[model samples]
Target chain A: MQNLRIPGPTPCPEEVLKAMGQQMINHRGPEMAAIMKEVAEKLKYFFQTKNDVLVLTGSGTGGLEAAAVNFLSPGDTVLSVSIGVFGERFAKIASIFGAKIIALNFEQGKAADPALVKKALTEHPEIKAVLVTHNETSTGITNDLKPLASVIKGAGKLLLVDAISSLSSINLPVDEWGCDVVVSGSQKGWMVPPGLAFISVSPEAWKANAESKMPRFYWDLAKHKASIEKGQTPWTPCVSVIVALHTALIMMEKEGMQNIFKRHQKIADFTRKGVKELGLTLLAEEKYASNTVTAIVATEGLDVKKLLKIMREEYNTVLAGGQGPLEGKIFRIGHLGWVTENDIKVTLDNLKLALPKAGFRS
Target chain B: MQNLRIPGPTPCPEEVLKAMGQQMINHRGPEMAAIMKEVAEKLKYFFQTKNDVLVLTGSGTGGLEAAAVNFLSPGDTVLSVSIGVFGERFAKIASIFGAKIIALNFEQGKAADPALVKKALTEHPEIKAVLVTHNETSTGITNDLKPLASVIKGAGKLLLVDAISSLSSINLPVDEWGCDVVVSGSQKGWMVPPGLAFISVSPEAWKANAESKMPRFYWDLAKHKASIEKGQTPWTPCVSVIVALHTALIMMEKEGMQNIFKRHQKIADFTRKGVKELGLTLLAEEKYASNTVTAIVATEGLDVKKLLKIMREEYNTVLAGGQGPLEGKIFRIGHLGWVTENDIKVTLDNLKLALPKAGFRS
Candidate 1:
């Protein structure tokens, strides 16, 4: 019953949750269209894009798939920069689409070199798109998408960014940043439950959709665009989530995007400072740290499982451990969405008490 | 607003709606796993299939795509029987995956003939799968899936049924009817909000998945199955909808599946008899009438639009118009899910008054 401190499904505001609990409406009705139109406009404002924003009913991974399937064709070469688990997921998903994947793997907690991505594009002029995860949630590292976008723009290829965990918390100018396609989810910084995923597609990406041949139907961008033009989706959407998203977007607008971003930065900085005061080593480089979450490396052979268990059972706080190869080596504390400085302080306080119980000297 | 009485997105039970309003939870946590396990088990009972049922965070169309992309490879042949709008969607989606489609077209108000499907399959032995809509909401026609299953079984090809509007309201024995893949949605007979799509896959469908060359990531059946084995999903699901589904399934079990189907049939029969008594003509033949919804043709040139408008504004009843080619030609009355005999009687009473206002002779 305690607050959700782990990355998303972050703690949604009571008003937003209650908005979803409202009576269900007919999806094809005009009432639903009003909500959809309002949410779509507000999302465009948040994404900083003049182009259409299409909402799909799925997770962040679904948004990633939509970006790939909508732009790249089978046998097309795609360069993916793998900084952590999500970046690797992008590579895996692209390969599943039969895209010739050219992955630029970096260290676990390090950012990918944009220069390497440029070199890959130079080596393979056949590459149609370069994929990057803007914020690698697994390691709490934020890759410099601007630099990567510069590299991609220089090559005249498309730039696709997975901004799932960093969209609202981080400063992403989809148009000004020269990104072709940016995908985000509702559960992360949007402070909504998991169900809706969105993508802001540039004109160039829309052009790419016409020729892409990776086989798509429900996720087809062209169909989605056509439906959006008429203020509808190709099929029924998650009306409850859409209503919740409309409320969340209105809240975001009232808070101001810049202010929200700065609040996330402040909380993340406070969390990092608090953890350092506890003498713990952060996972990623300070310069490349993400504002949404912070990954902490377990030092002195600490029992991470016991630490996480104590945090959950005793303090009633649920923190996430590293995924895939980094599992048990580190744990993550998410300070995104509705989280505040007090939340960060409380989590740090829990860590202060629970670490020693797990045989860690703090 | 008023209640949703359309075919899909029927009025959700109060408990189910409140369940979706529950606080969000981490999708990867133990609590989520427990809910998912219970949901999967209950779904098996409703589907009458011991086979695993995977839930996707999309609409019913997304579930259909999951079956298409996960089972049939590019250049694979599929026989799609199109009796109404949704059937054509099946063929179109299959073709999007590069499946060689053999569409067997039927009149709008008629059910697809199993003999025709047998003939098509006999002619096209290369067809990897047979796609059919169990209940065509557009035409209010329900195909005899049992006989169609025999044809598909004799052809030794996989059968994929779109039971989105029919499941739980009609008799669909996955094992007895020999359906290899059956797709349903939460908005339909499940009495939940629109978001989650459920699909039951047989071992035979799994075998097809092994060799499927279609590109897929988010709709990967194997990934869902692997995660479901651990009582998890590969990605975050529509958590609120899952909560709603869990609550709805509990209620469904208490009512019992047989009684649920019979209740729908009773409502359908009552509505049909009432419409006939009012001198209205039903769209589909009586033998092939759909239990979920009743489509009534606007005989004697009744203004379908005005009728629907009057019913909505005057009576607060939301009736569905015909889709695709039949648009504005008929009005559909849904009798599925939480719909009762009194609901049907009230709808009939409204139609009797609204018909005259729309300039109908009756």
Candidate 2:
């Protein structure tokens, strides 16, 4: 199989994959009750939160929308911090749901500045909510959420986070950070396939849900929470994926979350050093580089797409090219979720050989 | 494993289950593009619509919300026809999105009346849309969609269908019936696990997309359809379920749509006959009884929950208890997707033995 290296749909382990193939069981039965309770508990542990972490049968984007719609009403002012594509998406979904957005834009490859976020919030004191991306996958940047969360929470505003690509791969102590609503997906560092997404909602967020008036049904967190209390979901879930997630969570628990974070950090460091060996510049600055994925600025005179194509076709290693404005300017190497040291080495080896063919000279 | 006879999450075959366990892949890569395109084509075949059927990473409820939000704007006048719980959900979601609902209520256990629907539309001349469920799983009544479709079409109003439990098991030709938006899910006759939902949007619906004023983001059909044209979803999909769906669809094709429909019909007939032989009354009127799920009135003096518990604990069979107002009054037997003569016989055999134990003498 090719080394399928994408920021979100990372490789799942064989055991977890096998678990997904298990037959579908009664979703509203006794077994499901046990599974759901265990899953919610483990998810809380992974998120480092005493709050409820609810699972929804949708993608990460769906989870983001849940956080947005559940806590903020239509026309509620939101100070949105954007660093890249996924970061900007938080603001976009909120805006579509009628939240008045005060977008505090940052450079593509740079992390969000806490000072700038503070300035924006201060200027727009009416902004009831603060939206930030903990990990910007498009740019491979992980924001320093601790300080940002302090600013938002200290101001007594609701702090919502998009942790889709960061949660399990990095150290994100959600409750310690005072994040009111934290959203995540299964595909990034969960060692599972894409489908199910989760969001941790605090008591303050539930209060917001009581007052929020934006039009919603499927992404309604209130419905999901009530059903969870009853050991059911508001709707039929993707049972197979949830079971797979249960399996993946078991393995993750055995590995220990701290050790998982440390492994990712080490692999990310190795990948960055290897990319620098090829004379390629990192898109994200050193301190803020994401452990789940490493973004490299394409070498001068190199077609990023061609570089990826060459690696995929010749070396059976698939890498993601840049999205949006960064297209053809950067390529991302995912080293999360069941990735080994050898996997990173294989990707770098392919890049070293393919860069020369893409007309790069070093 | 018990015979899981839920209306939607029916038992899946072994091959489809095995396919779900397959390894993950690069969703943005060429292989996914091919798989997505093929799935879309096959979905169109199953939906019997030349129109684009968008696949979403959510449940059947999400698909229903998509139909409501994508077509009718907030405060638009909608004539919502309801027979039971699932039917009322259509109106409920639309109402949540701020649609002005003109609820035309029907008796439970009976199909929607075409003449009544026509009269309601005629009486409410300003009705811009009509909402109906093709199969009301709550009461196990399958509405005759052809006449209802004719009435809605003749009135030149958008006809949104919640075909969650009906589409593949029973035939309701989408294009021929002029269903502006027809929605379904993965857990039904597709013989796959829940996690994804499908919606076929007609050209008229796309025109509605231009004028829709309801707040929406994740349930946006336009975004889903635009991405599907490029062989992708707007968000990360349930990859494992999609692959399993691909496998299930292959088996379905080998059996052929006509034969699949016949099998469901025969199973429904056998299940209903078995219930009758046991001196149980069917909840749905004979003419409109659903071929996918059979709702039977609980035997006299029997506790529905106790009956279900007895079936599950003692007989190793799980049957759905009544929902909504039918709770404690009726129970349902599901026979859709991969069900055979043996499966039906087993469920009936268990029911026959368990009824007396639950205080019903039959």
Candidate 3:
């Protein structure tokens, strides 16, 4: 199989996948609880926080939903910053939970301005929380979350960050940045399959959880916290994925967090340089480009769909298309988890071969 | 590993486990969507309905939360029939969602009385829905869903059934029996590892969803339905689990639904007979015994905890223990999913060894 070039469910280490193949165990048993406790502790270490991290047996979107349901009440005003598909999804999810969302929209390939977020928070004193995406995967724009969190914190509001693709690939000190609630998934920089999602809760976020009146049960934070204190989960978790996460976290620990972040930056630099040398236009602002994935505007009049299809069918390389308004306008190449300069080279070579056949003269 | 004798995360077939180790795919891409469509279609076939089957990336409890959040609103009255741990959990989840609960409590190790449920609905006409557990794994008692559904349907009240352990092992003709909603898990009768949970909704349930004021986003029925109509999911799913589920459903189709049900019945019958020959007291009433697993009460002063530990540590055979008030009072033996007659023989032999160690003289 050609290497996966998508943002996530990126190529996982063979050892990580093998860890998931272990024999199943009863979820309510003590052994399972031990595994859960270790995962929770390791997650806190990865997030670089002393706060509690709760694991949800779902995707990163599920983690986002948990934050919404556990922190905001019906009719509560929330300021949402949207620059790409995932940013828009946060607004959509907030609306579904009956929250009155005030969305600040930006161009598809741009990042939301933290100044605009501050303006909205000041104007709407009723806004209880401000939602921002640390890394907008659709546009490959990595917003400055430290500044955004400062804006929200200065306004005396809770800050929720979607750090799904940015957690380990980029520098996100959850506590240092003052992010109230941060959501992430296992598949991205963790080098595992797409199953488990997690969120680290600050004391401020937990306080909001206490007064939140949203209807929730399985994703309820109170039950989760109570169970976590006992070294277990309120529900039966995805055991196989949890096992896989344990192995992945150990690898991360061995590499050291700072080194892992630097490695991702190096690979991202290598990929962006290669794409530029190939005469492709980067989608996001150069100063704000994401370190996990790179979005390239389709230049030289290339058929984005045809290029993606040929690469997948012939070379076995899978790339992601631009979601929402960016569809047919840009394509994304991922540089997260188990990805290296060599993998990026392979992807670029395939793109070079497929572009000519897709009507690109470059 | 000595066989998985527990109710869930039961011994999965090697092929099913290996399927989970398949290379991960980008969840937002068409490849993952195609896998999701196949899994959903197979689930629809297994559910015996043309209604939409939505999969969530969580455990069985996550599906239960989806049902409660999507169907009932805050201050809405729900009648919950509680006979065992799962039944009580249903009530707990509903209450957590701010639903006013009227519980119909039955004795432990017994099934809920259909008459009681009817009377409760008769008195409280404002009750928006009724939650019932088809098979309470905690007590090994399978309630009569048909009779209960008949009563609720006659009264035109919405019926939500937790058919987690009973879906593939027993007969639950969702449409014919007038079940408005049903929730299940992949780890149980689906013969796969824990990761995915599914729920089937009827027209009446859809109507309730339209008027429901519960705060939900990820578990929203409308969102799931809209995406399923396009043969996709709203967020990233457990792709490998979906592959395993597709393979498992194909195996189920070949076995035929009726034959699979009968097989469970035969195994359950043989187990009950063996327990009776050993002169052990059964926890569940014979008239309402579940076909999935059997709960054996500690007779002749047996140390249930010691017996369980010995079985696990020495023989590597995992047996479930009584939950809630019955903890340490009984041990459960599951015959659900991929269990053969020889498994039963091995379990019985281990029990014979454990009984004497537990200070049981016979």
Candidate 4:
């Protein structure tokens, strides 16, 4: 079987896969209530926070919307710091909900600059909130979130984070970073399939939810909190995904989140160095590179499409293409979740042979 | 193992369960695109509409939100016809999003009266839309949607239907009924697990979409339409569920939609007869009875909780407890999706033996 090297829908272990096949259960029964409670607690533990971690039955984008719609009101000024497409998406979600967005974006292949963010917040004193992406999957850069959080927290504005690709793969302690709202998805380092989105809300975030006037229903966290207290969701949950996530969490705890994060860092470092050995420069600079995915700049005269085609067709290794403005300029290889060193060995070995056919000569 | 009969999250067949555990694939890659295109077409066929059908990575409740948010603007007058709790929830969702709702509820255990709906629409000429539930799981009543749709359509008002528990288990042709938007989920008659919601939007719905002013991002159907044209969801979908859904659709088509509807009807009829033979009176009247779930009144002096407990603990058969006002007054038995005669026989056989223990002296 080919190694599916995408950022979010990473390969799940056999045990995790088997859990998905479990029979459907009563989402409103005692079994689901127990599972829900345990899943929420384990997620909070994994997030390294005591905040109220909520499991949502949508994608990471939905969780991002949940973060924005619950906290920001119409005409409420917010500073949105962007490093790549996902960062831009967080701003777009807020803007769609009527927030006045002061978008401060960085170039591709770079991380968000906290100095610029501080300056923006200083100038836009009307801003009540700040949105930042912890890791930009498209750019393969993990922003230094703590400094940005400190800036927003120091200003007394709420700090909301899109940790969709970072949390479990790296060291993003939600409570320690002072993030008022942090959103993540199950298809990342959770080693589970896509479907469930998770978010943790701080007291400050709940305060914002009380008066925020952006129209919402399904994404409303207040209803979620109330229903969860009764051991139920506001709606029928995606039970099978929860079943899979419940099992995946057990695996994560067994491996230990610390070791899982370190394994990701080690594999990512190896991928970057191995790609460099094949004469492909990395997209994100070494200092700020993400440990979950490695973005590599395709060499001049080498067709990115051709490179991907050869890699998939002959080498049977799939990778992610650049998104938005970064399209055709770089390609990404994911190395998170249950990704193995042996898988990387196969990927790098394939790259060594496949690069020549794409007109790479060095 | 228990035979779970909880309206939704019904027991899936072995083949369907096996598909849920399949390996993950790149959600944005070509393989996923092909699967998405096929899924949409089959959903359109199953919905029996030439209109656009969209698949979302959320639950049935999320799909209901999608219907309200996409068609109604804030302050728009809407006539919400309620039969049970889910009906009330649709109105609640619309109300939450700022719609001025004129909730016209029928007596419990009865379907929406077409005459009353007509009168409400006539009196409230400013009502821009009408909301109705196709199947009320709590009361086990499926409204006669055709006449209601005719009245709303004749008035040139938009018609939105929450068919979450009804669509595939029975017949409600989208175009024939002139429904602007109809929402269903995978956990019910689709014979799959939860986590996937399907929605169909009519051309008339698109007309309403242009003027609707509900603030939406994650559940926005416009972005979904744009993205799906290229065979991708605006956000990452529940990949494994989609894989399961794809397999389930194949099985569904093989059985044929008409036959599947007949199967649900037959099982539901058998369940009602079996319950009646045990001296139980159905909550819903015979004419408006739901062909998915059958709600039976709890015997006088019988504790519904004790009945449910005995059936579950001793007999290993899980039945749905009455919801909302029906609590302690009724119990519901589901016969949708992959249910067979033997499954229902086991449940009814267990119920016959267990009811007397809960103080049903007869």
Per-prediction DockQ = 0.82, 0.85, 0.73, 0.87
lDDT of 1 by residue, B1-362 (tens): 57457998888888987887888787887888899999999999999998889989899999999989999988888899888999999889889888999889999889989888888988888888989999998999999989899999888999999999999889898988889999999889998889999999999889989999888889999999999877788998899999889999999999999999989888899989999999999999899999999999988869998888888889988999889889888989888898889888888888888899998996
Q: What is the TM-score of chain A in candidate 3?
A: 0.98
* lDDT by residue for model 2 (B1-362), tens: 77888897878899988888888777877878888999999999999999999999899999998889888887899999999998888999999989999999899988889999999988889999999999999999999999999999999999999999999889989999999899998998999989989999999989998999987888888888788888888888888888888888889989999999999899999999998999999998999999999998876788889988898889888889888788889989888887898998998888888888899876
Off by over 4 Å in 2: none
lDDT of 4 by residue, A1-362 (tens): 87888898988888888889999988888888998999989999989999999989999999999999998899999988999899889999899889999999898988888889989988989999999999899999999888889988999999999999988889998988888999999999889999988999999889888988987788889989998876689888888888888898898899898899889888998898898888888989789999999998877566788888899889889988888887888899998888988899999999888888987885
Question: Residue A154 deviation, candidate 4, in Å?
Answer: 1.4
Tens digits of lDDT, candidate 3, B90-135 = 8888898789999898999889888988899999999888999999
| DockQ computed for model 4 against the true two-chain complex using alpha carbons | 0.87
* lDDT of candidate 1 over A1-362, digit per residue (tens): 67567788898898888988887777777778888888889888888889889999889999999998889988998888889999989888888888999878999989878878878888888988889999999999999888888889889998989999999889998989888999999899998889989998999988898888787888888888888766688899988989998888889899999999999989999999998999899999999999999999999767888988899889988888889999989999988988889988888898899999987876
Docking class of 1: high
Q: Indicate whether candidate 2 or candidate 3 has the larger DockQ.
A: 2
What lDDT score is found at residue A134 in candidate 3? 92
Q: What lDDT is reached at residue B334 by model 2? A: 88
TM-score computed on alpha carbons, candidate 4: 0.98
Q: List the residue pairs that clash in candidate 4.
A: none
Give the share of true interchain contacts found in each model. Answer: 0.85, 0.89, 0.82, 0.90
Scoring only the second chain, what is candidate 2's TM-score?
0.99
